[model samples]
Target: MPPTLKKSDFHYDLPPELIAQAPLPERSASRLLVVPPAPAAFDDRGVRDLPALLQPGDLLVFNDTRVIPARLFGRKATGGRVEILIERLLGSHEAKAQLGVSKSPRPGTRVVLDAGGEFEVLGREGEFYLLRLLGEEPLEKLLLRAGRLPLPPYIQREAGADDAERYQTVYAKQVGAVAAPTAGLHFDEALLDALRARGVEFGHITLHVGAGTFQPVRAETVEEHRMHSEWLNVGAELVEQVRRTRARGGRVVAVGTTVVRALESAVRDGELQPFAGETRIFIFPGYRIRSIDALITNFHLPESTLLMLVSAFAGRERILAAYRHAVAQRYRFFSYGDAMLLFPGRES
Candidate 1:
């Protein structure tokens, strides 16, 4: 490993006002910063010009995990307002969630959700509270009608009618993610069609982003940080496609960090394989990547694990320089911000 990267190495100054409070009016209208393979080559483009930028044979991998309405507001039996954000489902009717209220609800305390459905707090599990549903319908179905869209905290607005549709990607199908793959949100049907016309193949893997994604790294040292494990699945068909793409010397372009983790975690002995389970791979500047060749991702928070992952993919210094350029160019930052097309760099 490249001499255990210090957490301080990723630090940068970001203006509070630059953090995107709202998504772009048009998804594809978001800016794109193209970080070339080397420092000598620099080209900046708009997200709409991606089709002309990528080669014909490149395989653009995407995360198809759908964002669920994990945020639910309800009233405690004692008349206090309570907000519940589901973290993950433990069983058919049991789920783990983060509760926000004036006072912590104890076990056996009942809270009435939307449409009069109720949930009883079972107990605490680590940082999350265990909940048991009291109705016959599945939690997924109930949440669809009753819960609100769990927009990122950086977006300083309440969930609106448009957020339910706008926050999600056009390709989102499997329902599990608490957060949308922001990079994929830029691609509309027209862009997909345009990419297909240019011979860019597309495939999907699922990585259900948990609410833990928003948790900031508490460790001062990079090695001291324990990355959160998120569930991922890469099927056999996708594996076969990847192998075929490799055989033809086509580049594998991952759409988001979630797709990168899903692909890399599924590779064994340098060969891609079908995989399903949790992965806590904490990528930093020293880690050698064995799967993805290119990355399409959004601007990330300074000193964040996501930023560390990108720095690991590209050179840390190069990524930092690119970030400086983005800041100077007035590009938006965070989950709903502008994107970068990165070419993986050699490990130092």
Candidate 2:
């Protein structure tokens, strides 16, 4: 392994212009960068070419977590601007959210959400504020009526109506995630049907991505970083699918970093098992990944944990080199950007 790992080791130079602000006309029309396990030349392809990238028996696992409308503009009683992003629902009537306000309201203070939904601030919980809905409707219903889709911070634009459909995956079933499992965004019905016809097996896991996913890593060294906790559920069916894939000499391909964490968290004791709870698993170099053999993911923010996770799967230097190549090639970067099909490196 390399010497002490610094967060700076994951940093890369990206042109701001390369950040993708919008999705393409077709979901599967995005570009695909294929990186082999060996440290060699990379191949440029398209997302639609996934049908040909894997063998018939390979198992593809996707995160079925649905993206909720978590963002909204609100105001404190004193008229201070407050932007709310629901991190997680504590229950039917309560939620914990990240509030963007100059001065946070104290407990018992009421906030008027942009669309007139009212919520009472219960208290502060670290970086989040606990809130209670002031009406009979559940928190989810209130958000649907008043909130806008919380696009990533880099996407400089208001959430338009079109984003409601494009920002989510076609297979989103479990409703909880604040953010979409972007890697799955590239797989439309046509791509899914094609993969199924090609004999690719499918499975799912759920990991409700939290707002902390966008928070920048504050630690100077990678080891000092504390990963955010997210709820996950990995069932016995998927574990058995993985075992069957292994028996058939097929690979397990995780659709996104969320799925990677979900699968890895299921095997905390070095063996896959059913799991349902919060996970704070942090993947970095020197961490051997036995969960999935291949990964389908989008380009991630520089110095981001998602980038670090991908670097752990492939070698850090090779992944960074691939990032430089993607930059030179001018492939769109981040959430709504192009994707990569990666095979694990020797260490992984």
Candidate 3:
């Protein structure tokens, strides 16, 4: 740990009315704010403008982790209502989860799912519940059959049929994340094809975004707030792609924070390498970012780690100014909202 930054330093006032409750009918139609290398400067654009903004040889890294239906409503043996959000799968028949109940269920308590399956608490993993599926099916199968898409809480609406597709990336392949890599949500097959036709290269990484993404930073000092560990896999192919791109003087553009984290985590020991494990890497001011040349991302929550990350990438004052500008322009905010294409900052 290093000297801590005050969490309050990242705070900003956002109008609740700007919080996006639903996604636009078209993913690529979301407004794109192009953040130039000078952090304070902004260019109004659309996501569809991305191909024109990048060089032909640039490599775009995308997180391909799929969002699983991780939210389940159930009843305990005593008939009390319970909500379970899977945090991590431990085995085909077991998982770690956050259980919401009137009272935390004791180990051995059985919860009957509304979709007609059951699970029993095995024990606790800190604040999370370790549970075993009470049926023969694999945990993934049971969840897909019985669970609902766990939308971010700020959305203020129940998950609906549309979320099953809209909340996921069109290119999602690996199945595990509870939340979407929101920046990836703005790219459809057509947009991807357009980029490909322009000679932009693509690479994929997997990072199972946990439910803890929505957890507020509780520590007053930013460095004291530990990031929840999320499983990530940075493949060898992507490592090779990065080397090839930089060798050709092409930029390596990360699609979301997860891609940034995965790439950066792979190079923590000073050289890029394939990695498959958990990362609790927390990026903030004064941290050196070694992986990305540019980033395509969504507007993040005020006082969030994601915001801190962008601030670290582009200097705190400049990021906050862009945020204020976005607010003034009434840009939709948060997951399922608008996007931003950021160039390398002088501060990065």
Candidate 4:
């Protein structure tokens, strides 16, 4: 990590209009910016050009976590409206959530859902409030029946019918994520098939992306900030695949930051191992990245932890230069935005 990391060091200006409000007609139709490790003009390309950028034997590790419809609308005992975003399910009928009510409710206060069931506030858990369902109905199933897709805050619009499908990756399997792994969103079934046919290998890890991913780093100094923990699973299969790739001299190309975090966290003890647990591993500039040889990610918000992670993988100046190019080219930004394929810079 950098000896003196400032929150402002990762800042970059982006035009509001470039923030994509919706997905492209075809998932692979979007653009991809190939950023090489050394300083040079980035290759402006399309998402479909992936085959040309990556070679055979290289393993593309993707986060297979699915985005759940976690947003719910309801009201308080006083009939005041409240919006709930389930951050994590504690159990069948219990969850930790963020309340959107004007006034915070005290413990034991009941909230009735407009969609269906009712829940009483159990207490506070950091920025979240613990809620236990009044009835025994499984909270996860109820969320599927009642919750709305919680879109990113920057989208500036309600999630439409199309968003229900477009906001998720075609390969999404394990359902738990609150936000879509935007980089994975670029690979539709056809593109995945193309990559596989081109001799590219695939591996999957689960890192259920939380709403906290959108939260800004409020700390003046980056090291003072703490990351929100998210559940992840790096199964034995992926571990073996990574080992095989390394032995075969193939690159381990992480498809998203979540995948990078999960893989990097798994190798915390200096070597990759199967891991399944919550991780708050924060990667910033000056951190030696030994997990992945390359990364495929989306354009992130300025000063965001995601941006910092990429800056750590590539050089801070290199990443900022790429972002400036992305902006000047009017490339889309955020979850529904365009993608980038980055090669690693020298580790400090």
Candidate 5:
């Protein structure tokens, strides 16, 4: 019989103090933990060593989805404070968002923004509220003016001035994601230029990371957890890049789990195709990774789907051991923390 997989199998002990509350002053200054397929083997390096670690023709896939200022603070008609976090922008005036308040507002209730505007609660999409901004200005414009950068909850502080740029990746172009792809946060313009000089080809994909990424796994078994849907775009150009890279015997190194999901989602019927749609692909151990040969990603929460993904790529035991090493050695954890470079197992 196959080994039973439970959520507890992935749990690890993490101290609250280890969660990184702020980003390093230099984007590329974070440490890199290289975890190869060989069990119990890892090398402590720096993010600046990336170009050296990769082969010349390897394709580095990056997520270019820009993080919008998604967190909005406002008040209800009854003077109750409400925080609205955009889940997905519906149009220029409409968005689906998760609302936080003492009491849930009924339909048609107006929410007054601290930035001198209001949005009407139209209805609901599961737990999210369907909201329509009551203004002539576009939704993007309002968010820029009124919305705050939605840092991860573990950051333990309000968004500060530095967060405007520090929280975003240098290569971000497509403005849609609510959360920054944390792994890409380590790459500065200099690092990208260095990678290019080393002949590491680049490919772009867009996966607007949703706020639900931070949600805890409540299910008892790994397979029982449902993934949150996020928008992903894998253009024909990127598809061609992947094909060319493969034809030349080069590797496909994904920058983050978002890129992995986007690329893998594009592959259907045993081939990769251009795709632009929503995906809720939940990756865990016992899963096969067809699109990526390696990954660069930040440390993830224990029992989190992201951790499970890396476990899927490199054996679960090896990954958990690396995490323990990271913790013992005082390596930072979470969004604003250090990163890990993982090579795929032979069977993955």
Candidate 6:
């Protein structure tokens, strides 16, 4: 393998028009760039072709963490506008988040919520602001009525009615993630049914993707970067399914990088065991994966950790070449863009 690449190695020139503003008219209608083992093996296909892309007995692991409407716009007691992006709920009434405003609101400042409720900025802990929701109604209920979908920065638009459905995966059930697992966004009911009909087994894990996912790395070297910790749960049932799939000589395909992290985080003593905890694993080049045999992910931002993770899964050279192909073909980039099905090697 080549030496660990600098962040600049993953950089590419993407046209502004290719950054997807809205999802494809249909969820499964988006393009799929197949990065085969060799240059001669490429195929540009639609997401509907997923059933034909894989063999029988492949275990598709999905992150079922639902994206909550975590973004909220409100006003302080002084009438200054502020936007709060919830990171995670620390308790029923307390949470941590990133506050965006012209000026940072100091502790004990009251901010009126969009739902007619209010909150107090209790204090700060590191980069997150501690917020205390002040209302008789529960925090989740308040957010359900007033919170905006925290779409990525690249997607320039106000969250509309369609965004509530389009930004989430068809199978998303556990509500925690601030960001959607973009790879799973392409899987509609019809495509999932087709895959299941073609004998693909599916499993579910949870990883509440935090707001830090959108934070860029400022460090020079890969080792200098501090990964954000996210909560993950790999239950006993999913562990057994993975073990059983491997026992039968089947491949375990992660639907997104979140699934890969959750699966790999669960492995203890060379075998995957059930787990429920926080993980700060930063996967870059030279990191050997233990659980995921293949990955399906969207094209990531230039010089971002997500790009590095994909480079680690496949070799850096292969992924860089694939990105060039994707950009040259005018593939949409970022969260709501097209996806790539990556097989690191022939053997699992």
Candidate 2 residues lying further than 4 Å off, grouped into runs, are none
- The list of candidate 5 runs beyond 4 A from truth reads 346-348
Over the full model, what C-alpha lDDT does candidate 5 score relative to the true structure? 0.92
Candidate 6 residue-wise lDDT, 110-191, digit = tens: 9997668899999998889999998777788878888889999888888889999999999999989999999999999899
Task: Kindly state the number of residue pairs that clash in model 4.
Answer: 0
Per-residue CA lDDT of candidate 1, range 1-348, in tens? 247567788988888888988778888988999987674565679988899988888899999999988898899999999999998877667888999999998999999975668999999977789999987978888888788889988788898988888889999998888998889989988889999999999999999998887888888888899888789999998998888888899989999999988988998888899999999988887777779888999988778889999988998889988888888888999877899999977547
Error of 5 at 44 (Å): 0.8
lDDT-superior candidate, 3 or 6:
3
Better of 2 and 6 by TM-score: 2
How many clashing pairs in candidate 1? 0
Q: Please write out the lDDT profile of model 4 over residues 61-82, one tens digit for every residue.
A: 9999998899999999889999
| Minimal lDDT window, size 10, model 4 | 1-10
RMSD of 3: 1.5
Worst 10 residues of 1 by lDDT: 35-44
C-alpha RMSD between model 4 and the true structure? 1.2
- lDDT by residue for model 5 over 1-348, one digit each (tens)? 447689888989999999999999899999999998874468999999999999999999999999999999989988999999998899899999999999989999999998888899999878899999997988999999888999998889999999999999998999898899999999998999999999999999999999989988899888889889999999999999999999999999999999999988999997999999999999888888889999999999998999898898987888888999999988999999999999886443
* Per-model lDDT: 0.88, 0.92, 0.90, 0.92, 0.92, 0.88
> How close to the true structure is residue 302 of candidate 1, measured as C-alpha lDDT?
78
How does each model score on TM-score?
Answer: 0.96, 0.97, 0.97, 0.98, 0.97, 0.96
| Superposition error at 201 for model 6 (Å) | 0.5
Cα misplacement distance, residue 241 of candidate 4 (Å) = 0.3
Clashes per candidate (backbone, < 3 Å): 0, 0, 0, 0, 0, 0
User: What TM-score would candidate 6 get against the native?
Assistant: 0.96
| Least well predicted 10-residue stretch by lDDT in candidate 3 | 339-348
Global Cα lDDT for candidate 1: 0.88
Q: What RMSD, rounded to one decimal, does every model reach?
A: 1.6, 1.3, 1.5, 1.2, 1.3, 1.9
